[model samples]
Target: MPEMNRQITLAQRPYGVPKDSDFKLVETDVPEPEAGELLIRNEYMSVDPYMRGRMNDRKSYAPGIEIGAVIVGATVGQVIESNHPGFQSGDTVQASLGWQTHGVTNGDGARKIDSSLAPISTSLGVLGMPGLTAYFGLLDVTNPVAGETVVVSAASGAVGSVVGQIAKINGCRVVGTAGSDEKVRYVLDDLGFDGAFNYKTSIDYEASLSELCPDGIDVYFDNVGGPVTDAVFPLFNLWGRMAVCGQISQYNATEPPVGPRLFWHCITKRLRIQGLLVSDWADQHDQALREMAQWVTSGQIKYREDVVEGIENAPEAFMGLLRGDHIGKRVVKIG
Candidate 1:
């Protein structure tokens, strides 16, 4: 094993969108694991929208990242050394090891990965938190029946892509909205979305949705919350279900977004809107992972990864992700 561990640390609190200067890449001597701990060599780490919230000075559901601390993230890595009874050297495991090439953790929250089941990198994407988020957000939060029209925003993205495919499997008509025309095409042609549109070029979101969803939307999986979400409110059928999965549209905003107060429509249409945190379904994650793995293996669900080659590039790749530069899951490949 290498003697140095490279890490990305928070240099400053970001104002609006994060910039290159906000992060600092530094190296330290790889430390030995204490008792009941495992020393892991991170192979792949995830860059997610939620991490942006953690970069701020204020706190949300989780604590903010302190200055000079390694940025928090999920990683799939191999154990280089272990002191825990449950783990051993060469074991591939998944844990919140943050943005570093090496990390040490007690066995408490770490999960051993069965690499033979799928590529280990998948533990950060389709078969990991993103997959769990989609499963519970759609089926548990909002149960769409067969023949229902399900609309997903950011449809070609990690969680959204899975949500659309799962909805299709359940016999619901799935439509998606993507940031670019290419993404729209992928959602329609590749992922098998019933219909999709490029939100960037659409003159009227309401008109686009109306054209695609001739029948009213019975279930809406919201990933980007903004005008696109506003457009959905007016088109919902009675007792419509909505899983509020993400609000990437507002994550980097310098000011609070002001828009149409569409809650009145929810009252009349009987819409159910609920925010989701994948951790909320932690107890059932193993079951969800097993089922999603089957879907991936059987080709019932297809996924892609947008990978950045090095840990040093994670910040840049993450910024691009916020700008909607990549499709599917964005992950950093570190070794």
Candidate 2:
């Protein structure tokens, strides 16, 4: 016998773009299950650019959140009741618990969350998906061959910031682009990117890219698409590699931004452009976390967090992410 709970759901299927009205906050009786399931109260949830794509009624790497249904998200929580053998009432776990206050699990998808070793919230940021995304997306995809030149857009974001630093660690010359002068300096000075530029200050994406990457680019980790992507195309060295990560510039757009006028350059260079969702590499999450954590503890890697105060402000924090308002990993605190 237990008390039920309420959760939030999608208010509407976004048309072209999402609005705050598209999300519906609702209350419902807590879910109870037959057997081999666990019920828990979620603590913290992560807000990511990829979540924006889920708002639209379209097929993607994962199913989109349906209208009047709870929005999907990654959450860390503690089990309060359990009939499952693997989980107990006090067990801490991380899973796709969604944008609600509570959730029930079959005990299949949930993974143990260890707060004793590191901050529990890190499961959603540095030590979790974002970390793995930056790792595999940059190292595995781009290769960042030693002494080569690497450039990443959205240089100071969760994944971008880590990607640039890792590239430097691998002995590649790295440059990055950000929205503000402060972010530019953070990547260049703090993160040790060989160079950094503020894209907002220079409208001509090609000119800016040319100035910063005069040696040409061997690896291009594309975080934002549109004009920056177009600018990066011509600078690609022969057989250059491009990893198409989250495209925040066009995430809120009613339509995808158009650019890349230099498709011919790609053909001539025989460049390889690949798109990957970090979830696709879930199998490697643990390995990446272990190595990343070691680097972080030793000062070989650095992380920055842009934290929003409360759960109620999750939407505003998400909005800031789309507008490039955050300088690093963005998270919201919930109690």
Candidate 3:
């Protein structure tokens, strides 16, 4: 193992969209694991929209990443040394090791991974938090029934892709929206979404939704909240359910964008909208991961990953993610 540990720290809180200057990469001697701790050589780390919220000073469901601190993230790695009884050298595990090539933990949030079952990197992508988010958000929160029309925004993304596929598994008709024509093809042709459109090129979202969801949207899995959501409000069937998983469109907004007020539609149509975080279903992660792994291995569910090589490029990868530059999950390959 290398003697130096390289880390990406928050240089400053971003005001709008994050810039490369917002992060500072620093190096230090790799430290030895103390008693009860394990030394990890991280291989893959996740960059997610939720991390943006952490960059800000305000607290959300989780604490914000303070300036000069290592950026918070999940990582999959191999144990280099172990003092903990439950782990040993050569074991593969997943942990919240942030944006670094090495980490030391007491195994509080870490979990052992069966690398033989799937690619070890998947513990940070499809078979990880993003996958769990899609599973619980759609199945537990929205509960779409057979023959129901299920619409997902950011449809070609990590969580959105899984959402549509699982909805199909449940016998629902899945419609999706992506930022590009290529993503539209992936959503419809590769992932088997019933219908998909490029929202970037679509002139009228309401008109597109009307045509795609003639039966009305019975379950809406929202990822980008903006005009797309505004367009969905008027087309919801009575007692429709919505799972508010993310708002990527508004993550970097300096000021909240003003749009049509649709609370009346929610009341009149009897819509049920609930915001969710994957952490909310922490108790169910083992069960969800097991089931998701089965679906993935059986080819019943498919996933895509946009991997950027090198830990030094993590800031660039994160910026690109905010710009909708990735097709599915965006992860940084560190070691």
The lDDT of each candidate is: 0.94, 0.82, 0.94
Q: Which scores higher on lDDT, 1 or 2? A: 1
Q: Relative to the unseen true structure, what is the C-alpha lDDT of residue 265 in candidate 3, on a scale of 0 to 100?
A: 84
Q: How do the residues 173-202 of candidate 1 rate in per-residue lDDT, one tens digit apiece?
A: 999999999999888888999999999999
TM-score of each: 0.98, 0.93, 0.98
Looking at model 2, report the run of 10 residues with the lowest lDDT sum: 1-10
Tens-place lDDT per residue, model 2, 1-335, is 55546555777776655667776667678887559988878888888889888887777888888778877788888888898888888988887888766788897668888777677777787777888899999988888889999998888998998898889889999989899999998998889998888888886877877887888999999889878788888789999999999777777677656554676877899999999888787787778888988888788888888877655567677767887788888877664
For residues 207-286, what per-residue lDDT tens digits would candidate 3 score against the true structure? Answer: 99999999999999999999999999999999999999999899999997999999898899999999998989998899
At residue 328, candidate 1 shows an lDDT of 94
Task: lDDT for model 1, please.
Answer: 0.94
